[model samples]
Target: MLNREFIFSNPEVLKWIDNKFIFVAGDDWYRRRAQDDASVWFKSIARKARRGKNGSTQQGCYAVTPKGELLRFINTSDPKKFTVTMLEALKLWDGVVQDKKVTIPEMKNFDYKVNVPPIDPSKDVLIKVQSRALTEKDGKLERWNSNGKAGGKPAVGHLWIKQAEWQSIVQNFKTMEVGETTPLTKRLIHRIAKFHLIDNTRGEGPAWESKDLKHAKVTLTRVKNGFAIRGMFLLTNQKKSLSHSTELSGEITINQSTARPVSWTMIAYGKHRGEGKYTRNARPGAQPLGFTFEFLPASKIRPIDLVPPQHMRWQRGYWEAEKH
Candidate 1:
């Protein structure tokens, strides 16, 4: 997360730092636990920035309290301003990013007249997404079944993409064999999110297991406006042959409607394996590992369609197709 920690000359951030605040610059914050001494949290959502890609060196400061309270969120502007605000309680400056040029995505209405699979957003149309890594690894998690055999392999890969779609998504996907630079299209991410939403409508799973919840410190709590089934748990997993195992502790939330999760969040924290395409720094891996399910009515969505990757590519190559 944070590659360097400086003894702040300014007393504002310093106080939090002294009180155990941590500063990080990446989405890694969402994956790992906040530092032990961190009373304040600062993270940068800088995922990646490249041409024809959805990634960008996030130019924002997402400052929050230790107890998970929003303090400041400044995107694509002078980040140092955040430090100034931290110094003053009443003083807060935000929403100072460069104005994004307005552009509209080509929208296409689906052929409803034909036998387009009738879908009901509500009810059983739930998006049951297990922890991408923890959910279905075919015992490749190196956790319970460290043998790394081909047992519980998922039908799809992370980002919930099917094999056919993945091939198309990676069509324009360029990368350097030797260098660290890699690129991903912006449309791809959005499509993946859309796919996740659609594919999940065809499944079932829990935000977490009762067995895991049994060990968690479950409680009834209020979030925003509604009641929630909140729980905290410290979990450990190891293979019998391994010398040491991994330990994780995190909080989970199951919003109103116990029988049907209205909106729930589950995050788990553990050691960092420093394994992945890009290991930015050395920090304990805090994974948002858990099952999350969400459902939405078609009426609530935008006026567009989930067309094939080829269609999008053709649109991009078409004369009127402007750069996003």
Candidate 2:
């Protein structure tokens, strides 16, 4: 979050980045496995970095040539330090390119399963999910910040609704009278409660198990030209040491002629307690955490933003979370 709000968000830094380099974002967790030639080549460059010690994470910025020669690498969250590193990298790049000509290598045996795109973009509905921790101040909730670092910026994620699921929702809307309410499908409700609701603001949180979902309920009420959605959920680990209790509310506007959702917005707000292996440091007790979900139509979605959901490493488990 710090890197995103400080470095990437800076217009001046972005200008240098856009003009000098071909930036690519990747998930090091999966890339480290070297499923194909591209990943293998990436590992060769990453192995030279400071964090490249065998079996440890090789996650950081790197300046490399087309033939995979590492020029500069640094792992720092500070914007000034990152900018300095980029400048140094550019100087080295200028020298290397002038001395030797490098050609891009043709990739063979690319791993599609490692970083899969959206499942059937024509039929799937994409929703952007943003999460952040909140602190109560002046009798109202505000973004949680610690000494101008961490927890201030929202963490982003994605959610996909399958064709059949969305079609069911639209059909339900058509059959209901104005103001009449209907519960969401068990599959959809459990999927959200078990996977999407968590404290990912700090880091990657563990997915809730089926047994951990103590309570999950959501409903949609037909309204004027749309539907009103409301729900509540409670999830706890097997040990009952960690838990999240949240209330959700949202509005979905539909295209009357096509019976498709034109806009969908939802918010989940409640108290969260405990932490996971990757996501540590609790706030002493239950603390306020919030999440917002916004639908992004096909036209609005960019190719870079089409990355799969976090839990999608195991595609079957993610798509059928309710069953598991």
Q: How would you encode candidate 1's per-residue C-alpha lDDT over 29-140 as one tens digit per residue?
A: 2222223212112222222121112332334445544334455454432325655555442232133133222333342433222212222333322222332323235544
Quality of model 1 by C-alpha lDDT = 0.29
In candidate 1, residue 315 scores what lDDT?
Answer: 33
Name the TM-score of candidate 1: 0.21
- Worst 10-residue stretch by lDDT in candidate 1? 199-208
lDDT tens digits by residue: candidate 2, 1-324: 544447777777777777688788888877876477878888888887756567569887888887777889977767778899989988888888453566766877778677554466556778888999899999988988856655556888888789889989888878889999999888888777877898887778888888998888999999988889999998889897799999999999988887667988999999999988877776768899999999888777887668778887777777887888
- What is each predicted model's overall lDDT from 0 to 1? 0.29, 0.82
| TM-score of each prediction | 0.21, 0.88
Backbone clashes in model 2, listed as residue pairs: none
